[model samples]
Target: MTQSPASPLPSPEERRRLREAASLTQAQVAARVGVSRETVRAWENGRTTPRGQRREAYAHLLASLAEETAEETAEETAEKSAQQSAQESTEETEAQNATGGRDMTVGQGARERADTAVRTAVPAADPTEVEAPPPEARAERPLSPAQAFDALYAFCAPALVRQTYLLTGRRELARESVERAFELAWQRWPEVACDPDPAGWVRATAYDFALSPWHRFRPRYRHPEPPPSNASDRALLNVLLELTPPQRRALLLYDGVGLDLPETAAETEATTPATANRLLNARAAVAARLPDLSDPTELHYRLVELASTERLRAAKPAVVRDGSERRARFWTRAAIAFTVALIGTTALTLRTAPTQYEPPVPPGETVLGVPPRVAPGPLSEKEQKLRAKLRAQMQHGPERLAPQPE
Candidate 1:
């Protein structure tokens, strides 16, 4: 015998049990079940019953509602753990900073000890939580602008900075560009927050800022005009200019940016090792022209030191504003006058000068007057002896030095 259609509805007790199990309010259930709260109330109060599919959907909605009590309990536990770890890390950093510059061995030892203590004291993620794909899942999660800003600053700030520097050799310029990008992000926080790659947007924005006219007007400190005889500084400048923006970026990203190979690839949207290798090759082509440094670190430090010493005052307001027009006009007139003078000089030289039949130049002779090579100054007896010893050592089959030169 088949039951009547009235018997297809759920009993009041069953509805109550399902709602309690699923942790849903009448409104929540009604919304999910395609009905009003009043309708749900009538069913729950046993004045009416949902029919057929409506009854099944109501049951399904109740079953799917989240159990709020369990979620809150887990969140509290996780929050406590996170707070404790953060406090420990902050303490550790402070202690390490306090020990700066006494004995290297002592400072290093102190840091190691602090780090070990924090590692031991901090609670590890629970086994169940650890086994879950939280890291993978987080990529899918949405973050508010403030939350994303905090996360990116803490984890990706260093990487982003290095990336910017890689793209632009000018440190101050790169920093300013990154600052502008962050400002833009802040202005459009709500829109940026919804983006799949907010960091990418910032990076692209930085790229644009670096190329802006205002950025060009930004003060770029360089060594004061060296004497004409100072060939080294001139050579360095030429080498620096030879590097294209992308090549410089590759070097900066690899060495200066502090990113591992894979991280750099991800940030730059390169495929794999091969792409990084191509970038490296491009950098090598430019670095090949630069003056050879006995120690690259020394060169880096010297450059940074020089940069720090230079006062980078803002450019003159008038010049930055509309002075370009006046300068352009002046240069245009000057150029025309100079060009006319040059033509007259060439005409006079060609027409008035008597040309004689010239003999072929000697093999040893230079067409342009060649400056004589300067003779080396006499070395002291001790210095001469040291040089001789080094030459002899080099001749004797690659003898290793007692100390590797820094």
Candidate 2:
């Protein structure tokens, strides 16, 4: 059976086309459809769709638009016939008109089937629900980048914080890890937003940040935090923290986060066997500490329970975004300042440094012009005479203890 006409809307691209081809603006369509301009914009962007009376009205408006542009866009319509579900109905209507049976204009025909004018809409096929487009398709949507970032942060932050808490057993570390990850995401938003797994991107980033061994050097994260109040909870947290960082992360990703082994390995940057070994070791440690949590499923639930018992709250998206922007600005200014300083230092050195090389003075050499000393025999006679005169003048204050050279 064909679904109700109100259930489906046109593809976001074609919805905008139908309105524009009819020479109508979004505001005009929105006004006619009794919705806000943003609602109409969202509908056209595939961010959201209209519903209830608004759905009927929006569908009716689109039908009227198609009829107005039916002739002008006949070629476009023909090209899209294979892609559309209503081609048979459209051809039959035109045929009836030509045969003089149930003759009616495009608008009249649309009124008869206004609810189902554009059945090519893939996202809003169910009137009661709107399926999200694939990440690839979402990346192409021309919505505000900030809005998309905020939406993603809001959806993933809280859960991520809890998960990180399980990984590290510290509430502050978990919160900081998530915030820092988002900050990094915002800094490189172009890459992150276009990624096939934006959530995975953020998740991997958070995991890396949370599991960093360097965090142990920070004074804040160095001290052990107070464990959960309950004995079992504290014991479980202790066991988790006791595991090696890799083991802890692997266990958390595979069991606690419900990721498969391959995914856990990829995220942890390890081979499948290594990740499996880490999980096994981590599970063994936890089970040894608390035998009741030996089962992987039970361990997952316990990890969840332990994480929830802690008061882990992520900062608001605005706070995160503002901090990210602030950090980026600070680093930019720092880089510029450092560059200027380096240039000034180089200029100072250039100004003070010697322009010409001056050869060093040579060491003194022995002189060749000095007179030679007299021979010992001639010097002995003069020395004896001098010594006798000196002894006479000195009056021999004390007898010479030993004979002089004379």
Candidate number of the best TM-score: 2
Model 1 / residue 197 / CA error / Å: 8.7
> Which residue pairs show collisions in model 1?
162-257, 166-249, 167-249
The candidate maximizing lDDT is: 2
**Cα RMSD for candidate 1?**
39.7
Q: Assess every candidate by TM-score.
A: 0.30, 0.59
Off by over 4 Å in 2: 1-141, 368-406
RMSD of each: 39.7, 15.3
- Per-residue lDDT tens digits for candidate 2, residues 156-180, read 8989999998888888888999999
